[model samples]
Target: MEEAHSSRYSIHPGSTKMYRDLREVYWWNSIKKGIDEFVAKCPNCQQVKVKHQRLGGMTQNIELPKWKWEMINMDFITEFPRS
Candidate 1:
């Protein structure tokens, strides 16, 4: 478990991923709970844990354009085949 959690290849995967990877070759009662507890206790994991929260609130309304070309839209696409 320690090697799988801290090895260079593993790199401290979150409990879900760790559980998935471990279950491929190992299984036991309460394994998911164990992995969750392990990750929760890991200082490294705690340090870099991502916070799950709403990214952006309600979108603000944009002012209506009062003149031609006031609001311009463009799209750029690369790797187009030439005719």
Candidate 2:
């Protein structure tokens, strides 16, 4: 069971993929639950899995400008033909 869960071919797939792969040649009463537990304990999976939390939120400065247009910004764009 440990070999299947941490084997090279299995490659630490998620619980679903592990369950399906194990089912190809093995059977058990709590296969899904066992696979979930195994994956949850897998160090490699924990190390590389993407976190599911939101990233940092947007932020804006609250400082005031001393004069008009002091804090304003502009961008100039020019287009040229491709020859």
Candidate 3:
């Protein structure tokens, strides 16, 4: 996918998806390991890799609310952000 605006820097999936559709959730854990492997192959990390048809489905509870500010919280998270 071509980035709407860019300067040859590869777009992180998180940034691109959010910019185009705020509700789109690009779950890192939900995608295949191969997606990361392919991106890592990009020497500049600026290549916009094409999206392919994924063949699996997973629904997780995601117990944490709004993920803690500085941590990857999957099981639980505090409402407050540390200062």
Candidate 4:
């Protein structure tokens, strides 16, 4: 995003084809990079005025468990008698 955004200010704006060529070289047809997505969705690129979005309620993410379910499953099997 920084490169794309900076390109906007660079007076070139992907004019040199470096970004596009590099995309074709490394990404090899996968078109979902965050920077490309950002540039594609840029209001400036679309020539549309940016609208302010209202803040939405934030949702907290659940904490990650320290171990995998497979490990816990083995423990559960050993610790519990047959039901």
Candidate 5:
């Protein structure tokens, strides 16, 4: 369990992926629950996991230019080495 959870075998995978990995070579009742508990308590996993609900930062709106080409921004639509 330690090996799968934090040793070289692990990359701090989420509980679901950990469950799947364990399922391939091991089996026991409450295995999923155990993995969930382990992952929830894992400091490294908590730190590395993405926070889906947290906003990154405050957003500011861009002021529109009153005249055309006043704030011109261009992009190359064609592929590189254009003919």
Candidate 6:
């Protein structure tokens, strides 16, 4: 399990993919549950897992410009001479 999960070739696949890969060569009762538990306990998986929840707070609206050039955005990069 550790080899299939954490090895350079596998790189920590999620429970579903891991189960599919492992089932071809190995089988055991309650294997799905075991894979799920193993993935859930893996710290590397937890750190990078995508969150399914909505982002916090409401979106704010930007005000429309009332006149020409009312709102201007500029970015400048200047190189200074080194002393």
Best by lDDT: 6
Q: Number of clashes in every candidate structure?
A: 0, 0, 1, 0, 0, 0
lDDT (Cα, tens digit) per residue for candidate 4, span 1-83: 35544555553254234466556555544444645565666555555423454556798896676777633323343566779
Q: For residues 40-66, what per-residue lDDT tens digits would candidate 6 score against the true structure?
A: 999999887778445668989999999
Off by over 4 Å in 5: 52-83
lDDT of 5 at 64: 96
lDDT at 13 for candidate 5?
Answer: 72
* C-alpha local distance difference test of each model: 0.89, 0.81, 0.45, 0.52, 0.84, 0.92
lDDT, residue 14, model 1: 87
| Top model number, TM-score | 6
Sliding window of 10 residues with minimal summed lDDT for model 6: 47-56
- Extract clashing residue pairs from model 3: 10-46
What TM-score would every model get versus the actual structure? 0.60, 0.55, 0.22, 0.28, 0.57, 0.61
lDDT of 1 by residue, 1-83 (tens): 89989999999988999999999999999999999998899998887765643456788998889999889988998998999
What is the Cα-based TM-score of model 6? 0.61
Winner on lDDT between 2 and 3 is 2
Model 3, runs deviating above 4 Å: 1-10, 14-30, 46-83
Model 1's C-alpha root-mean-square deviation from the true structure amounts to 7.3
Q: Cα deviation in Å at residue 36, candidate 2?
A: 0.4
Model 5 clash count equals 0
Ranking by TM-score: 6, 1, 5, 2, 4, 3
What value does the lDDT take at residue 72 in candidate 5?
77
Candidate order by lDDT, decreasing, is 6, 1, 5, 2, 4, 3
lDDT score of residue 35 within candidate 1:
91
